[model samples]
Target: MTLTRRSFIAATSAATGLIATPAILRAQGKLALRMGHPHPESDSWQDVALWMNETLNEQSNGEITLQVFPNGLLGNDPTMINSVRAGSLDIALTGNPFFTSLAPELNVLDLPFLFRDRDHVARVLDGEIGDRLRRNFDGTGLHALAVWETGWRHVTNSRRPVVEPADIKGLKIRTTPNPAHIEAFRLLGAVPTPMAFTELFTALEMGAVDGQENPTTLILNSRFYEAQKYLSLTQHAFTASPLVTNADKLAAMGEDQRNLLIATAQEGAKRQRAMNAEREQSSLEALKAEGMEAVEAPDREAFRAIVAGPVQATFAAEFGSDLIDQINAA
Candidate 1:
């Protein structure tokens, strides 16, 4: 059955009210968990999902399995997250920015020029700083399983190469509805249009928006180079995919089942992060090979000078600088 976004959400919303649970138990006594993500099946999100399914199925002796939905078939990131929270969906994998409204403190992760490199990001997310951030998910109806990597975001536009802060001025850049992202672009003098990822390619192709920002893997997989002419290695911010499940769903499982789920998720997170890091440069080269005008070195320090200070200050004033301070110290 082909389900439109409206129908899908309506069905899931109705399921939330009508069904006491997500109906994980299927015929022949198998428990099938439904997992959805916004990325394509070829992306790391699906890769990890499949791995978890196989591993869990093997470990559980076919007692448990996963039914995967990729390419936003369930809905956009926020919609899938709402489904997970409302108990209509079993699990969702989404970038951290989408969770900020549920736990506003998560906005810290999206701040521009936040981490020095992938190593810094690993340190922050694997250490005490990661624990503090995940704790914010409590009471939000979603339980964080693990944080996976999405790599650093860069700018791709039809206008021109974004070599410096001035080059981004007045470009209609499509950004996630993340306050930090929108504000950073606004500060850089670009008009940031907060749009859903599903609508982004058409928006760029139709010229509704001039360009967008995302990791290289996504840009290549989505073929943004078809619409955008320039690829700037802005490395503006790092995005983390927090794989989460409904708290109720987790509680419904047996103790052993719950433990198995958490253990498998964390294991998958580590493998996915390593896969993403290893593919980062190769993905960039692939995009360039596909004819993207790659700006190998943008004036990142100059861009940071304009964006980081004020953005961090605004965030600090609103959320208190504890998370940011801790991340920096880490």
Candidate 2:
């Protein structure tokens, strides 16, 4: 019997039999998981969220459902995270840095030059290191379902093209509320201002921030080009956005439902990563058409060197020397 993905899922559901629908599973009383992210509905993050909703619902035969709140509708990343911890929010898809305040070990993934490329990021994430990070979330009142890459970050601004570290001097850049990201731009000579993703477009349009750094897909998906002109391919950090659920809510699920949720999340993550990569490739052309100067071959190593030492020192105490060595070796 050739078992396809859909067939395998159906078979597994049959094996689990007709499980009693928890009161929370009723149509009127369905447990609605509120997932928050900073991207609009058109973004890749939303694509993944929709996929999870569809897959999880089908797998559980409508017993589990997800309600997505996109474009920071619930609040900024930090606010959303706090809500999740407090059990007010059910789930969220957010950058790892937001959770660093809770789990410092996650900072290892934020090191400026740690990942040589996308493949390295995936290898480490899908390997023991990723498992270790997931394990660390056990007692944090949250459960990490999967880690998905957002591609390498690049700098986009209305100022002059950034080809070297010195060019970024005095430029006001908006960054996520991550210490490492703030320090990175500060070390590169830009004044990094931490802000919510939803506020970025307005901040740029109003000249509140000279530029910001994000992946190509983000720059295009968020229509950052409407407010910025120059894009520097610094490729500084490869961000991992984890799909996290409240531990209490997750713990209440049956074994079959739990397994299905995790499986669906993993599958959704794969789809998200592929969509992000595809968007990254085509975003340059889209930006160019929009009259944005896409700067290429910028001295990435020069910028990397600026933040390398400080970021390493900041995280060395948490990740310890061995894991850092493993990432460096990779």
Candidate 3:
């Protein structure tokens, strides 16, 4: 049976009743917030989570603090995201793809070769384009707080180097369940297998999939180099992690408290973005040091030329080209 978001929520709703909320509201009006993400404790996601916790404590004069659960302790991306929407979880951090089902307009950001660089991403995501996409969260039970960078995604495989589109032909590549990503890989001549990120490493180790694509930071932090042999700097697409909270929960908070929560999250996002950029080269170097062959200059133009037109047209037909045009113009 296929599990849609609604069904997943229903299936998990009963289970949620058994889990206690980690947050505490003191008699003195102080509140503790709980946040969760799928990345390990060593990744930048955890670093920012801790940073935000400190900032929130200091800014709130000890009235507010965060309890962070990393490495999918709460659940995978989709589960945690649904928990937040269902008010069982306070907050969640997940890549754009995980939220696309709740807001399909976000698929625009998942397009291959869509973002030229970090600057282009900043221009779009930190501007009106980002605001418009965040508004899409309304009525979905999530309050979009801020946009954080996951960096440009690259391809890694155990089979061989993937420098051009043809190199990946017939190879099974694991991808996020984002339609744009699946469509892009399919157009590039590879079998696109979509699955949860949690299953990727074991699948690769067991030869369930030949390769996978992810940000250099995630590839290194997740230790994919142990199972994958080649690292191609495809930069096929950029991913953004949206920090979101339960919409009803946020609305229930005092005006000042709500503003503080949003403001601190955005500030944390800025720091995470800078840190992500600083670590990109170092992460790539670390992957190479780990014995993975690095394809420094893969034929990006060739790869992009193959998937750009068709993928964009297919998405535009469904989502309209106005947002795409706005992003391009930005």
The CA lDDT of each predicted structure is 0.87, 0.79, 0.86
The number of the candidate with the highest TM-score is 3
Error of 3 at 24 (Å): 6.2
Question: In model 3, which runs have C-alpha deviations exceeding 4 angstroms?
Answer: 1-18, 22-26
Higher-ranked by TM-score: 2 or 3: 3
State every prediction's TM-score relative to the real structure: 0.92, 0.88, 0.93
Candidate 3 weakest ten by summed lDDT: 2-11
Candidate 3 similarity to native, TM-score = 0.93
Candidate 1 residue 185 Cα shift, in angstroms, is 0.3
Clashing pairs in 3: none
Model with the higher TM-score, candidate 1 or 3? 3
The alpha-carbon deviation from the true structure for residue 298 of candidate 2, after best TM-score superposition, in angstroms, is 0.4
Could you give the C-alpha RMSD of every candidate to the true structure, in order shown? Answer: 4.5, 7.3, 6.5
lDDT of 2 at 170: 97
In candidate 3 the C-alpha lDDT for residue 97 amounts to 95
lDDT, residue 8, candidate 1: 40
